[model samples]
Target: MTSDSRTLQIPEHQQDGAAQKSCYQKLSDEHVEELELYRKNGLHPVHLGDVLNNRYEVLHKLGHGTSATVWLCFDTQTSAWKAIKIIGASHSSDDRPELKFQLQLSRSDLVALPTDHFWLVGPNGRHVCLVMPPLGPSVSSKHQTMDLEALREVSMQAADGLAYMHRKGICHGDFRTGNLLFRLDSARINDLSKGDMLALIGEVTKIVVETDFGEEPGSISPRYLVHSLNTDIFADFITCQIAVIGLSLAFEITKPPKTSSVDLPYASPQLLLRLPPSTHSDVWALGCTLLEMQTGSVFGTAPFEIMQSMELLLGPLPKPLQRTWSRVYPEEMLHPEGNTEYLTWRSDVISEIKKHTRNADCLLKELAMSRKQSLKGLLAADDKNKPGSIVWQVPEKQVTQIGDLIKQTLSYDLHTRHTADAVVQHVWFDQARIHRKPRV
Candidate 1:
């Protein structure tokens, strides 16, 4: 269960206590000391400029999250760069359906996995490390900027990856921007020379610093250089990865939807309320993410904010979810303006909601009320859809296409949501348009 307990092929004479202590020192970075107190399937600590088995040399600490510390490592043996994710024991049982799914396909059919895992003996103990091809910053990183064209490309590629996985019966449990990284070539950076775009990718690709902090013995943080990457490339790639993360979850392509925990803001209503996660749920999350990219803010400021936002803009939940919501916060159901579907108590719409959710039909009687809207009132001051508002700033043609595409994916009615394959075929992305070609 602990990496330290795992066997290492080091010779006994060389693996003395003092040597082991020294090795541990060499393997540490900013968070390594805290990470050294390893948890099961959790994060293992890492230091900057460390070397593993004299093969993979840690160049710089890239990033760290709850699960692992990622490093930009230089592979001495292959004379190339790679990403090394040093992880602990907690996720030992995390089912990576993609691995099995990939085996069934030819190399050409598969996109990259987050990382290809392996084990390495370190100063503290043995660690499970994932070795991946080197890449640049996260698309969600603060520096990223996206235009309409870039977003479309991102959506298309993401759909492609998800469609491949969905067809093989897998769901990406966690689909978010941080997990998606990109590598932009010199040619792409050149595209940025057009405007302030150059600033988004930063000044250069490589930088040699003593450490993320300052100078020390193991202080050499070797970052590589290629060309300054463009922000658009990062955005496009991230959108693609978001799709991949959704497909990575557990679900049979041909079966009913399943359920799992997800981030609060991006979580589908069903996921938030403990309902089964289906292809539709992923669509909902995608809608929220895309919206965030467009507006630079989440739909809600808090739990109540989300509920209020959904009721106002997206509509007052599918009948089943509404029924569940009404029970917990019965007060929320009493809308003075009659915001339950444009003041029309359409039995047919209720029937459809019921038909889609066979279980919900049994939970509540037909929802009958004059449809009124709370969202129009809340956002009345600056309706995002209006002409004078920021949303309207997007080119007219693009606004309709992008909004329609995202809305279709965010359809509150699960049945109305777009599937990954359907998303790929969307006219918004399929429509003909001029594209900038990179020489590289």
Candidate 2:
């Protein structure tokens, strides 16, 4: 077949939602010539078992989104399995302002973002097909739930990946459970047995040793030695940290909090309001995703519902929120003092969850303890703020400093937020021996 080129119409706004859906819809009406080019260049139609790019032999369809269809494929050359996500673009697109702009921007800046982070895996080419690691079935596919420690390990890796991206001034735009993958046995470095329901329950639960809270200060904890053995997180941390050394990107000012339901509960408040996401956004999503992993839920709310809910519960915005919002969202009309109210609402929600749900309550207790220890260093630093109040719950002798850093990484404000690189320098990462050179 001869090379054919065509462009299909894609709405400007929809480009950021889902790439798979965008590709399929954009290509559905494209000219025959463009279709010919796709077939000739290796990105054939969404047919089962058809090989694309002569390298990836489609084995089965994995999942599909607006812009693309992901297929489980085998590499003819490597004799290894891979994920191929086809984002079909045409040569004759008449309209697609948002998509065009994003594509143009991605093309210019995308390469700048380091792709070597193992946890941040994706395809190597951009012509149309997005390559990725071969993913096992969903977490639920193996068992109803995973070990909390395993999930934490996975999250730590994801954090490393996000830190790398943030350092490079890149935002994932969409961060969700669906985007993560569990490596297969053949892909694993060690001969460790594959996970199953039994493994989920039987795997040793990791205990924390190094205390972030000052309450545990001067305490020697053996549990701190149980940091994750997951390789992806380490690789991501190393590579991303190197790549994101210097890049300036626009960051949004948080507006005052109006009492609205979370639009994308998993997305950071900044990103939810269309602000440029930063390391803090990644931390926020990580926190939300951790909640999702515990509860098995996705996060979102319709605009109308959000507004109605916020108005009913919050009553009215506080002054500080109004000032913050005015600076963040000048064009959008928002409740004058919404940000402060929103934070209160958030605290209330967490408190309510702790009171109501056993699982959430337990987690909140653990996290709260962790949070207290995280600020241990600053506790004495701000004795003026502490007056007579005790800064920590656990005795200072037993507290771990790592707990404190983790808490700050998840701080609410964007400006006061610590960079991912900064987080890696914490005692936890250091004690984990993540960056230490192996003895020759």
Q: How many steric clashes between backbone atoms does each model show?
A: 24, 56
lDDT of 1 by residue, 240-318 (tens): 2222322234556465455576676777767766677666676676667665555444556444556655554454576
- Predicted structure 2: lDDT: 0.39
Question: Pick by TM-score: which candidate is best?
Answer: 1
Model 1: which ten-residue window has the lowest total lDDT?
Answer: 363-372
Alpha-carbon runs more than 4 Å astray in model 2: 1-44, 90-127, 137-144, 186-263, 294-300, 303-363, 366-410, 422-440
- Give TM per candidate: 0.61, 0.45
Give me the runs in candidate 1 sitting further than 4 Å from their true place: 1-41, 93-98, 104-111, 121-126, 142-144, 185-259, 328-392, 432-440
**RMSD to the hidden true structure, all candidates:** 12.3, 19.1
